[model samples]
Target: MKNMSLVIGLIAGMLFGGGLAYSGMADPARVRGFLDIFGHWDPTLAFVMFGALLPMAGAWQIQKLMKRPFADVQFSLPDTKKIDRKLVIGAILFGAGWGISGLCPGPGFAGIALNPAPALTFVAALLLGMVAHKFST
Candidate 1:
């Protein structure tokens, strides 16, 4: 079962990576271009997001009929999920980094696999931050 779980995770990651590659989303520069408000803002990312979300929305509707939850895991539906101060602060930090570097965790990790130069540095910094957070918190 553990092996199966690992296999499933691997397969999911592969599929996600492939899809991102196909959609040109794995490149964070594309994401930064999309997020650019004052400059040239590309809408392809938004359209792609909607295309992906449409099917997921349908699947969510179908999920209501399932007798048991997927993987038999308890899924707690969040109640009153409102944006708070933490969310705003995090968003500011995230937006600032994204705008400056055009890199996030997903593409940073993927770029490491693809042997990109700058992404390697970003991944190293990200890992260090994660480790530091673990000890600090």
Candidate 2:
């Protein structure tokens, strides 16, 4: 069962990385273009976002009907509902980082294979940020 889970995870990761690469999202320049609303804005990322949301919306609906996930004993969902200062600050920070680097966690990881140097730098900074957050909390 553990091996099966590992296989499934590997396949999913590969698919996700492939999707990012194929969609051109793995490129920071492409992502920055999407965020460049004032000049040479790329609408491709919007389509990608919508495409991702469609399947996820359906999955959420499907999850509501399921007693438990097929691979898990129980559904592991976010329990937080409150919007506090920490949440707001974290969101602002996340947006700032994404805008500046044009690479969030998902794409950052995927970029490691596509473009190693920049991705490694981003990942290292991301890890440092995570560690800082852990210690601060």
Candidate 3:
């Protein structure tokens, strides 16, 4: 069962990475163009986000109806409703990193197979940050 779960996860990750590359999301330049509202702006990212969200919204609704996930594992859901200092600071840091590098965690990993060097650096920094946060908290 654990092996099946791992296989499923691997397949899902491959599909996700392939989709990112195919959709041009793996390209930092494309992402930067999307973020640049004052410069040569591109709106394709907005459409991509919308397309992804539609199914996600439906999935959330379905998840609410389900007792457990398909894997029979307990659904780990967020219980927080309050917007606190940590959340605000985290959001700011995340936005700054995204704006600067044009590569968030998902895109960073997806880009590894395409452009390895920069992607590896970003992933390494990301993992370091995660470790730092773990130790700090």
Name the top lDDT candidate: 2
- For model 3, the superposed segments whose C-alpha errors exceed 4 Å read none
Candidate 1 local lDDT, 1-137, one digit each (tens): 55666776789888877877788776777888898868988778887789889888997887777764554354445786799986798689767876676777776777776658888888887788779768975
Taking all chains together, each candidate's TM-score versus the true structure is: 0.77, 0.93, 0.93
Query: Per-residue error at 120 for model 3, in Å?
Result: 0.9
Give candidate 1 misplaced runs (Cα > 4 Å): 67-73, 76-82
Instruction: Report the alpha-carbon TM-score of model 1 versus the true structure.
Output: 0.77
- Per-residue error for 14 in candidate 3, Å, reads 1.7
| Deviation from truth (RMSD, Å), model 3 | 1.2
**Lowest-lDDT window of 10 residues in candidate 1?**
68-77
* RMSD of model 2 against the true structure: 1.2
lDDT of each: 0.76, 0.92, 0.90
Query: For residues 19-124, could you state the per-residue lDDT of candidate 2 as single tens digits?
Result: 9989999899998999999999999999999999988999999999999877767888999899999999999999899999999998999988888999999999
